[model samples]
Target chain A: MAAADKVDPIHQFQIHPIIPLHIGGYDVSFTNSSLFMVATIVLASAFLYMSTASRALIPGRLQSVSEMAYEFVGNMLRDAAGKQGMQFFPLVFSLFMFVLVANLIGLFPYFFTVTSHIIVTFTLAILVIGTVVVYGFAKHGFGFLKLFVPHGVPGYLLPLVVAIEIISFVSRPVSLSVRLFANMLAGHITLKVFSGFVVSLSAFGAVGIAGSVLPLAMAVALSALELLVAFLQAYVFAVLTCMYLNDALHPSH
Target chain B: MFVTSAYAQEAAPAAAEGDTHAGTAVPAAEHEAFPPFDAKTFPSQILWLVITFGLFYLFLKRVVMPRLGGIIDVRNDRITQDLDHAARLKGEADAAVAAYEQELAEAKVNANKIGQQANDAAKAQAEGTRKKLEAELEKKLGEAEASIASIKAKAMKEVGTIAEDTTSAIVEALVGGKTDKSEIAAAVKSASR
Candidate 1:
C-alpha cells in the first residue's frame, strides 16, 4: 500500500490551499476551509435577506419564521442581558446565524468544516470576549474591576475568591472556542469513521454488503445526532455570549 | 500516575493508525505546519465577515429595526388612545352622574314646594271656610236676639194694656154707679202703692 492511501482520519481535518499564492514573507494560501466559511456567511445573509425582503402585514410563512427567530433571539438577549441587551443583538444574532450555517454546510459530502478549525472559532470567541471587556471598561471605567472582586465575600476569603474570578474570566474565550470547535470536530470525525466502515464492509460481495448495514445504520443515526448538534452549538454559542455581555453590563451581579 | 500511563498506552496505536487502503498517508508536516492564508481565494473569511456585517447592519438599520420600532410605536399609540378614550368616557359618566344628582335635588325641592303649597292652600281654604261659617252663625245669633227683644217689647206692651184695662174694670165695678174720675184715680193710687 502507498503512504497516501494510509491517511489518518483525524489528519483528514486539514486546511488545504484552495489557490496557491505567496506574499513577501507570508505564505498566504487560500484554503478550502476559508471558501466554506465565506460561503456560509453568504448563505446566511441570503437566507435572512430573502426571508424578510417583504414585510407583509399578515406575514407569509417564511417571513413569520424568520421574524420568530429574530424575536426569539431578541427576547433571549433581553432576558439574559436585560433591556439594554439590544445593543449586542446584531453581534449575537450574527454569531448564531454564522455558526448555524457553517455547521449545517459541513454536513454535506466533500465539504470543508470551517467551524471545526480552532482559528475560526477563536476569532468569534475573541470578538465576543473582547467586546465585553472593552464595553465593560467604557461603561464602568475603573469600576469594571469590581467584576473580579466578588461582592459580599468575607474579608478573609476575598483574595481566594478574586483569584477564582480572574481565572474564570480569563477562561471565557478558551471555553467558548473549544465548545464550538470540539463539537464540530468530534461529530464530523465520527460521521467520517462510520461512513468509512460502511464503504469498507461493502467490498465483500453480498455477505460483506449485509455486514455493511450495521455501520450504515450507525452513520444514519450519527448524522441525525449531528444535525441536532448543529442547532445546539449555535444556541450554546449565542447564550454564552449573552451571559458574558450581561456580566459586562451589570458588573455587580 | 495510573491514569496518565493508561491514557498514554491507549493513545499510542491510535496516533500511528492510518488508512492504508486509500494509499494516502498524511505527512506529519501537514499536521504541524500552520496552513497560512491565501488572497486569491474567491470566498475568504475576512471578506465573508465584511459581507455578513454589512448585510446585517443594512437589514438592522433599514428593514428589521424599523419594522420592530413601528410595531412598538403602534402598540404604544394604541395604549395611549385607549387610556384617553377611557378618560373621556369617565368624564362623560361623571357629568351624567352629576346632572342626574342635580336633577334629583331640583325635583326634590320642587316636590317639597308643591307639597308645601298644597298644604298652605288647604289650610287657607279650611281657615276661610271656618271664618265664613262663624260669621254666618254670628249673624244668625244677632238676628235671633233682635227678634227675641222685639217679641219681648211687644209682649210687654200687650201686658201693660191688659193691666190698665183690668184696673179700670175693677174701679168701675167697685164704684157701683156714675163716679168714674174719682174711682179711677183711687184705683191708680192703690195699684201704685
Candidate 2:
C-alpha cells in the first residue's frame, strides 16, 4: 500500500496484531504492544536475576547498579512516605522497574513504546491512583477525605480551596498518564518528523540532499534528548506515585 | 522543487487509494480509527497489562525482591560482625599492653631494690675491714712502747753503776774515799732531772 510506503510519522505507533485472537466476541489479539510488554518483563526479570545471583559483599558493576536502583527507589519512598511507607516497597519497586525498563527499551530503533499509548499509561496511572485511594480509605477510613482540606484556610476560602483540591485529586490519573504519554509521543513524533524530512528532502536532488543534513542533525539531537526524557519521565512517574502514596498514608493535608 | 512537489502530489492519491484498500482488508467497522485512540483494543491491552503486571509483581515480591533484601541483610550482618571482631581484637591488644607495662614497672622496682641491697652490703664489708686493721695497729704500738720503757730503765741502772765505780776509782787515785752506790745514784738522778 502507498500509505505504508509513505513516511507516516504516526505509523510507528500503530498496533498491528502479531497473533490475532478473539475471545468472547472481544478482540484479545496479541499485538506488538503486548509483545514489547512481554519483552520488557523478560528483560527486567533477567537483569534482576543476574544482578542478585552472586549476592557478593563487594558488589560487581551489575549488582551495584541493581543496588543503586533499589536504594534510589527506597530513598524516594522514605523521603515521601516515611518508614511506614516501606511496606509498599514491592509495589513501588515494581512500578519503577517496569516503567524504567519500558522507557529504555522503547528507545531502541524500530521498537514500540508501550508507555506512549494513553491506554497503557492511563492503566498504570489508574493502578497508582487506585492503590492510593483503596489503601487510603482502608487505612484512614473516612478521614481520607481530610486530604482535600488543607489546614489554616480561612472559612471563606475553604470551599474554593477544597473544590480546587478535589478537582486536582480527581484529575491525578489524567495528569500522571498524560505527562508520560505526551512526553514519549511528542518526542517520538518530533524524531520521526525530522527523520522524515531527511528522507523527503533526499529524494529531491543534490541541493535537497545537502539541505537534508539539518533535519538529520535535528533528528540526532532529538534522539539524545528523548533518551534523557525517557529516564526523566519514568523518574517523575515514580516520584509522583510515591507522593500520592504519602498523601494516602498521611491524609492531614 | 517542481519535480519533488509533483512526486508528493502523485503519492497523495496513491496513499488515499492505499488507505481504502487497507480499510476494506480489515473489517471497516473494526478498523482502528486511530490506533492509539481505538476503544476496541483497550480491553486486550488492559487485559494483557493486568496479567503481565500481576505476574511481574508476584515474581518481584516472591523471588527477586526477597533475594535482593536477603543479600543486603547478609552483607550488613557481615559488616557488623567484622566490626565487632575488630573491636574485640583491639581490646585484647590494649589489655596485653597494660599487662606488659605493669610487669615492666614491677621489674624496675625489683631491680632498684637489688641495687640498693648490694650497695649496703659492700659498705658494711669495707667498714668491718677498717675496724679490724685499726685494732691490730693499736696492739702493736702498745707492745713497742712497753719494750722501750723497760730498755730505758735498764740503761739508767747501768749508767748509775758505772758512775759509782768510776767515782770510787777516781777517789782512790786522788786519795779520796768512794761514796755509797745509793748516794751516787741519787746524785746522778738529781743531775739528770
The global C-alpha lDDT for each of the candidates, from Candidate 1 onward, is 0.73, 0.83
Candidate 1 runs further than 4 Å off: A1-67, A83-85, A101-114, A140-143, A151-163, A189-228, A250-253, B1-47, B54-58, B61-63, B83-102, B140-193
Q: What are the per-residue Cα lDDT tens digits for candidate 2 across A1-253?
A: 3433345666667666767778887777788889988988889988998988998888899998888888898899999999989988888998888888988898887899988889999999999999999999999999999999999999999999999999999999999999999998888888877887888888889999999999999989988999899889988998999999999899996
Candidate 2 clash pair list: none
For model 1, the TM-score of its B chain against the native B chain is 0.61
Docking class of 1: incorrect
Error of 2 at A224 (Å): 1.0
Task: Quote the lDDT for A1 in model 2.
Answer: 36
Query: Which number leads on TM-score?
Result: 2
lDDT of 2 by residue, B17-60 (tens): 43322442344353335556777678878988887888888998
Q: What class would a CAPRI assessor give candidate 2's docking?
A: acceptable
Q: What's the lDDT for residue B180 in model 1?
A: 59
Best by DockQ: 2
Per-residue CA lDDT of model 1 for A1-253, tens digit only, reads 1122212345445444556455554434455665776688677767766766665555688767767667777888999999998888878877887788889998887787778877677778988999999999999998998999877899999999999999999999999999998999889888877777776677678999999999999999999999999999999999999999999999987
Off by over 4 Å in 2: A1-6, B1-32, B87-106, B128-190
Model 1 per-residue lDDT tens digits across residues B143-170:
9999999999999767655666676777
